[model samples]
Target: MNSKKRAWFVLGITIIINILCQEYFFTEQFINFNPGRHNILYSAPYFVIGGLLYLYRKEIHNWMNIIGGWMLLFCLVLNIGYFLLPISDLLGHSLFPLLIVFTAYHMYALGSDKKWLHNKIIDFLSGISMEIYLCHMVMFRVVERLHLENYISDSNLNYVVTSVLTICLAICFAYCVQRGLDKLLLKKIA
Candidate 1:
């Protein structure tokens, strides 16, 4: 299989499975599931992808190697930071999958030479990652602002409602704002 196609396949499958696990299994049914377990599962694909890239390092693009190096360094820092900060399951669990994404990107970017990835259009969409990162916090604030919490209890139904609301707002409002900002910034940067 072509490396690029393989990369996208791995990335897409990984994302879909992770989201399904979070939304359905972890949140809806197994509310008490240990986050650490899910983190490992989430990061598994990245490890495989990263290993493949490392094994085929010679065929990889130099820019990918450069980006992968940075991602590795970043994961190293995050790992160390987790160790020093007194490990919280929430933070550790969340960071693990991202570490995987960093690894996958390193592998994908290294294996392929696609300058369009760094082009203004793609860069703008990528910039929305920041918005995705902060969406939960923003969602929480919005929920609080509307005093929606007062009516909802910590039950399965409440979980569904909250998750649905958060996902919707995150996808709609937060992403939209992020895209707008990214476009504005792209014009200046590009």
Candidate 2:
């Protein structure tokens, strides 16, 4: 089979697996067995979807240009329906795979043409996103340990302040780690 055919096959299998995992396998026993949602079975489909998106990005971009507006409207309707309608948790959860894929596709297509999305802060954050993900939990723990919540009397304001401070600390830490890695790699190469 050709590469395109293989990709489609993999995508189909992953989507089925994702649906099955989300619908049936996400029980308390499964959660206990796979603590922190760290199981590859739970995340592999998303990684596959992301890979496929990148692989056919150009083709998808052209298709998006042709149907982007209609797609956006459809996604908006889905979002409104999902939020406003009194749907059962199981029904809503079942639709998650489709909803997430459509939302991600539309976001990519719509955001591609927006100049505001290319700002310096966005660029910097994107560069260090992986690092930020890696260290964010540690930063949150540090914030909690420091008892920063006591400084603000209002619970809501305290939550917001601590969240923002934690994110800022995480960003700084990620930036430092990235820079240090870059320097270390440069030194080894030189």
Candidate 3:
């Protein structure tokens, strides 16, 4: 199959798997594995969607330029409805993922061409984003171990402080790891 055909096939399969795992085969083990809405099954479809977006980005960009505003308004209405209305289980299961995709696509489309988003800090953060993801759980644990929550008296203030500290720690750790990997790769290449 062609690349486009293969991408569509994979996208379809992942979407089917996501719906099945979420709606039908959501067993206790699955629930345990995917605590606090961190469902691994959903990742597959989203990854595939991202790939598809990149694959057809030029076409998608043209289409977005034409009707992006209308789509954004539609998404806004759906989002309002989602929050205001008592959604049924089936709709909630389906609509939530759709909303996420729409929101992410709009964000990407809007930000991808912005000159202001091309700053040095943004570039550095983007470079280490994967590393940050890998190290964030450890940084969260470090924050908990340090008892940063109690460092502040007010509950909300403590939460905010700890959250900021955790993010800063995670970013620092990720930057160090990225630098180490770069040096190691450079040595191997040399």
The whole-model lDDT of each prediction reads 0.63, 0.71, 0.71
Please give, for residues 99-149, the per-residue lDDT of candidate 1 as tens digits: 554665565655555575578766654566557556765775676476555
Best by TM-score: 3
The regions of model 1 sitting more than 4 angstroms off are 35-43, 59-97, 100-190
lDDT by residue for model 2 (34-90), tens: 422345665666656665666677877777667646766766777677667765776
Lowest summed lDDT across 10 adjacent residues in model 3 is found at 29-38
**What TM-score, over all chains together, does every model reach?**
0.33, 0.61, 0.62
CA displacement after TM-score superposition, residue 154 of candidate 1 (Å): 30
Pull out the clashing pairs in model 2: none
105-173 per-residue lDDT for model 3 (tens digits): 555554354455588988888899899988887887788798865566799888888789889999999
Off by over 4 Å in 3: 27-36, 62-82, 85-92, 95-107, 133-170
Q: What lDDT is obtained when candidate 1 is compared to the true structure?
A: 0.63
Residue pairs that clash (backbone atoms under 3 angstroms), model 3: none
| TM-score winner between candidates 2 and 3 | 3
Off by over 4 Å in 2: 1-3, 22-24, 28-39, 66-74, 86-111, 130-170
How well does candidate 2 match the true structure in TM-score terms? 0.61
